[model samples]
Target: MKSSAATDNSSHHVKCDKNNINDDGNNSFIELPPNSRPLEHQIAGHFYDQSKTKYGLLQHSNGDVLKPLLNPPRGPCEEQFYIDVFCQTSKSKYNSEDLINLRKFLPHYLGTYKCQKMSYIILENIIQPFKHPCITDIKIGRITYDKEANEEKIHRMSKNSVVAEIGFQLSGWKIYRSKYYEYHDKRCVRSLNKTDILHGIAYFYGAPIHLRLDVIELVINKLNELQDYMKQQHTFVLISSSLMVVYEGDDNDQELNKSTFVDVRLIDFAHVFPQTNSNQSDENFLFGLANYIDYMKQLLDKNYVYVPIDKFEHDNKTDTKIYSCYKQLLT
Candidate 1:
């Protein structure tokens, strides 16, 4: 119910309009999470409200992703609901960076609603129309510290963990937070979990074999743009951020030489904090993003016969900048 002052930005200013929200707007807020089956319809309805200038999403007093609604559009686009189990840790108000600093979006945020006991944000579904959509979470970030200590902690937890069959990845990292055995199936709705708040899981959409290079360019360019925007906001994405891509299984026309088109969005904002440790934040995302860029290059090199960088070229400066960043991470 409180709105904090927007952080000073060199290139932009962010503010919330008093007319865009009503403190007593809980009339539309549900008390449960969005996975309780019975409230699915209720939670899904928030995305369709067009009466307001910006859509309302539920949030709490502490800036967590639930129990309160955050309004104010970043651009001329529709407002989006930014919710999840994680809340802002430093201040009393929600970190406006959760939505403002983002360079990509799942879709326009509508408002907030809950299913059963958990709260959920309703927004335009990015993958509803894509066919046979399969999303994989790639936990990306530089492995600077000896992962041995982190891995050991994970090992100890596994020894005392519940024997749930549906959780845990091969590397023992927990990624089952929001897996739908079938993405398009309605029966797979579940509560958001700890991984949603912790892991920087980037969901890469499977693209046709031919267009992999184009897609990788799209991903890289977006990250570069994001880094610039984050710096302007005087905020840095210090934590792990994700890249979610949604694509189709449409015909890979052997004759149509063009790269296949895809829709991609970045998710997860738990580690995105204020600009206190800007240097480290830059290190985390630059190296982390560079690492992902290399991964894609390797995948395309081995699987495809052609690699065309011009499909999404910027300029010589960009190529040098990106390549140089890649070299830094590798060396």
Candidate 2:
């Protein structure tokens, strides 16, 4: 519901009229509607960094999202990745089950949009189905920096040592509870221990017991589907990507729609690259997925009380059965 203020970068300015967008041959690239605004609930990726851009995703009038392409190779690489997965043609070579089934776990790619010499990738808004959505962005993979990372970038990422310890990090989350939303940004979890992270996850799915059970179970099922796809493929090394978990946060019984209750999708593919060799799967991504799944299963197995984050901060020594779930990670 928020609009990004006009930035110094002219490329980011929306200057398209209906005719300019509609004339892009075959009508594949649609124009940004006048009402399009920056997505307010975005949790992860470059969007949150003030210097990256004052804007992130623009929610279109048709309920889709317009994601601006980053500069250079990162932009082109992401565009090509989507094209190879979705726009299958006679000349394309990325048709493996790994790539094909990606649709099951990723936002549907509509097409590319170019306006005033700037480009954007249009994708289905993953949260469109929910009334009030509780969302979390979990960055996957232990080795987040790719071979392309410069020394400075590598040094910066290395400082967040939790990624190497647990194979993933709870980058950010926005939860709706008691008619209000609580947000924890990426910086909050960077230095957290494995136990504190577990508490954070607990706080994420902090719905009423009955609703919490259903949401966690469904989310776990979705993760399993992604896990199955990741295990069988040795195609791309997904780096610095994230698993976006969203669920309906409107707890009213009448508003609860089981069909649209929870959704999971893979997001942020700027660093995704083909594997060095055909025989090796992306173990780094799989390891993170596996660890997250284990944590969810433990939640289902035990009735662990959901501790409010503020309470956890003051008295983290709460002896709940949930802490026993990932004893290995803590040690």
Per-prediction TM-score: 0.42, 0.80
Q: Which segments of model 2 are wrong by more than 4 Å?
A: 1-33, 90-93, 207-211, 303-308, 311-331
Write the residue-wise lDDT of candidate 2 on 103-222 in tens digits.
667787777666654577877788877877888999988888989899999998887676787788888777776557666666665546766677678778883333387888899988
lDDT of 1 by residue, 1-331 (tens): 1122122121111233333323355534322222222211112212223224223333332333322223222111111213321222243233455445452443434344433222244334444444433343333344322222477655653452211222221111111112222121111111213332111122222322234455556656655665455445444343434555544434353553234345555544434434565344455555555545544555455443332323122246754443211111111
Model 2, residue 226: distance off in Å is 1.0
Lowest-sum lDDT 10-residue window in model 1: 168-177
lDDT of each: 0.35, 0.70
**Over 4 Å off, model 1:** 1-107, 143-211, 227-233, 236-240, 253-260, 278-281, 299-331
* Model 1 C-alpha RMSD to native: 16.8
